[model samples]
Target: MSKFKNLVVNLSLTLGGLFMGVIIGEIGLRVASIEGYQKIGDFVDSAPTSFHTAHPDLGWKLKPGASGEWKGEGASFVRVNSNGLRDDREHTKAKPPNTLRVAVLGDSFTEAIHVPVEQTFWSKLERKLGNCAAVKGRKNVEVLNLGVQGYGTGQQLMMLRKKVWDYNPDIVVLAFFTGNDVINNSPKLEYDLYRPFFVYNASGKLVPDMSFRKLAPLDRNQRAVSFVDRLPSWLVNNSRILQVAKKADLDLKKRQISKDFTVLRANNFNPPKDAVWDNAWRVTEDLIVTMRNEVVQKNADFLLVVVGDPIQVNRDPQRRNKFMQENKIQDLFYPDKRLEKLGNREGFRVLTLAEQFKGYTEKFQVCVHGFDNSVPCGGHWNEIGHRLASIKISQNLCQQLKQSQLPKR
Candidate 1:
């Protein structure tokens, strides 16, 4: 009898302890969430309107869209549907009865931050191109800015394959930024599984999938945890942590990182000779081949526009030279001079803008992600910079168009 009583008492105590622990853990998590909310509030209070909109949980004033005007804490513009392309009211769509649909693909440079939709390179290019009699009266050319900020080549490819492909675009202009595209292609601690969320599966259906390569060994729970961690806002706002981890991951990158990491580094940047440039090249080559094949299968012309950063054309040749000299890092821009050689070898249209806009760097004290005057420092081009880039790109496109029309030899 006493033994049975003791056993019951022990079981009760154990159960009670577990119950208490669970309750405490729940309270702790709630406290953490509240504290997190406070931190987010503080962050929003100090951040810019753009920053707040990007992170609404951080105490940003929200002005919901009313009567087609979408006003918010930082943005003064309203969102309106202009000829199927959602743009600001200031930037009207091309007078239709004329419709030339062009899709612009890339990262932030293509997205055109810190500038109004009218000022975006796409809008400006549309205005410039639509005015031409050759393009005018013949259905106004509509440039769809499909550029999402912080997307890498892989993401861009995925986006194009899934989202932009259905548009049946007349022209697809890929603005390739050389600076961080390589890095973005690589994997890190906090992977953005959400960015390239929708991928066209074998069935030709867009399905939600994580961007990273799958690990066959991961258990269901582990996969679930990874999925939760990759939530859009969670991964994006916490990107700083990933950046830090990436910088520190140089050593363990080989064994722990995905093959795409090595591939992107080798083909996109200058890797050390002993480093796996060959492997990287093979991977990128495969990706390019697959992308090209897809383009061909779709009967769409694939044009590769090689865009470089200010560092590529800075007056101080030694700016990049130092990194090369110290780390023996080769210039990824000229990876085997493939981008250039491929243009000549494969007839791929390549537009190198490093030298074209080199002079404009002087107008701003900082180059490649810094504020000129009081603007924030990041890779995104300022309004004027974006305009200049757009003009240069438009001129290139015009030349390409003219060349395409010429009788084939």
Candidate 2:
């Protein structure tokens, strides 16, 4: 009885020390200025009206009628409509009379939770297009933003068919952010696997890969949160130790993938030297062409907008030049030029925005990208960036519309 009592006392002391240490650690983390700790475990949520939810077809989607405050680079209240679009109001399947409809597609840049809905590029484009002669007889213009965060070209194509066609848009603009869309298209390159992918088959034809749906919750690591993710939000949010561990794990994974897939590196500007990268580019090009063909078949115009990455549009010429020298690339617009060539070959209009954005940066020394909390000139576009994109896109789109000689419906 004496020995047992001693053992119990020792065990109690050890557990008590650990409990106190954890409490102190949690308090320290909350006191620190670390960002993104209030929500932990998973990058997304699965609840209805959550930021994102599991989809039977698309892997994940903006939960229809979801509302939340988005913070990172900037703060904005994002409200998803009943149709799962980040918009002020629900859109109709049928185009309204005397209204010209334009559909925009891409990833987070197009979704743009960093800024207000009225300040997004597509929203501003609507107001701009309304004043232009692009639709000679149309009294109004509607630009539908069909973008979702973390989406690649494969998922965008799926969206074009599953949701976009129902709206009967007169134009389809694909906002291609070259920074990660290449990796996003490749299963071997992209870490997130909850979404759909296209893989080349034995006959060199691209086929759909929907295996993610069959994986267990933990394996997917997306779409649905796992047991680890179910830790009380307050505990996870306040625990410095847990936050450090999670960040370390994420960094390790990113470093492992970066060994082959370097983001914003020379590989993106130059030709692929390996099969994996070659396949990634091929898959992306094929997906773009497929989207264009589908839109053209429906008598709608297709425009591929090569959105500029922040590094490519840095206000300081020294930084831009240094990056170019380190990357050993003569041209910063290599990806844009390549995509422009593809659009020319495939009979769709292309607009390369990097050159314009770079010029704007050089002339004004103003940063269009990044938010107050992020690295300087890094991350998504700010209000100025959206405005510039809207101005350029509206101008180019107006020209293309006039050239098409579209009928006044």
Candidate 3:
């Protein structure tokens, strides 16, 4: 009986000692502000980390005139116009005479909330186009950016119908990202929590549904409820020590899972291949054809640009090799070529930044938009990336517009 009591006492003492040690370590790490102990969202109060107003049609959109100080992988002050656009200027219903207006549509690549408004491609393109217009005797060139982050192609189509056409554009540019878009086509799992999605019907026609309910937005009246969404993370993240411990735990989990991890590829979100991707090609084709028809009915030209993911453009040999081999990704140009083929068949000009970006990457490290460019990193575009895109698109667009407006000669 004495032996048993002693064993129990020792076990309890050891556990208590370990608990106290953990508490002490946590406190020490936090007080030091040791590196890699902070949650990324703790620095940014924007979409993905925060919720915006919900729409039954487009899934989510920033509140018009919503301005927030942003700090993230890249930090910038973000502002949205009254029209739910991330531009500083307001667009009127009437486009000025002798003006060429272009409306850009897509996901975060086009939205680029991480960068300043002036630094965005559409804004930069707008500035460059103004100069070009001045030389060509055109009055003005307006580019409306109608990008919402995390939007799927179907949601983009819905947005085009619900909001964009009011701008009376001369050109409509749709940017496609190959990363998770393929899987975004269907709303099978937690997709409803993300965005309004589409599914393949019995006739194999793409059908849109927002039938699944979205999470109710945080209520200002219900501070307790509203704070609930952020509390758990906030509590842990505010303590740098807990953040470090959590990160270490996550890193260990990732390493362990990575051994058995099958790369989801640009295509495979697994079950979504059938639920989402199986109809992705057909649905995308239909949506583009429909969107183009909608634009042409208004006498606007449609241009499609396939944006390369960071993985496709990563200069790091180790990370690049892993993505390539895991996804059985042979050609880096696979997305561009596939999109170009579709555009050709549809009789629209499709351009890709793959070759253009590669040319620039030969001299510079073309990495994802983030604070860091190291391996196991990034999927977004930084300011430089946006600048590169703006230059290429602007030059090409000006040339195309100038040629199109050549007095029908």
Best by TM-score: 2
Q: Write the per-residue lDDT of candidate 2 for residues 1-409, one digit (tens) a residue.
A: 9999999999999999999998887677668855332334334443223577878778889888889887765778999999989898889999998878999999999999989998899999998987788575666899999988889999999999999999999999999997888888987777677778988789987778888777654556432332334567676566677656556656665566555444434567767769988889999999999999999899998889998878789889898788778778787777898898898898888988888998998899888898888767878999989999999999998887787676767
> What local distance difference test score does each model get?
0.52, 0.82, 0.69
TM-score of each: 0.58, 0.81, 0.73
**Candidate 1 regions with alpha-carbon error over 4 angstroms:** 1-86, 89-98, 188-281, 313-326, 329-332, 359-369, 372-378
Report the C-alpha lDDT of model 1 over 366-397, residue by residue, as the tens digit.
45433444324334565655677777877777
Quote the RMSD, in angstroms, for model 3. Answer: 6.7
Candidate 1 TM-score, true structure as reference: 0.58
- lDDT per residue (tens digit) for residues 40-105 in model 3: 342222245342575556656877888887775566788888887888888897888888888999
Candidate 2 residues lying further than 4 Å off, grouped into runs, are 1-50, 221-266, 406-409
Q: In what order do the candidates fall by lDDT, top score first?
A: 2, 3, 1
Model 3 pairs whose backbones collide:
369-380, 369-381, 369-382
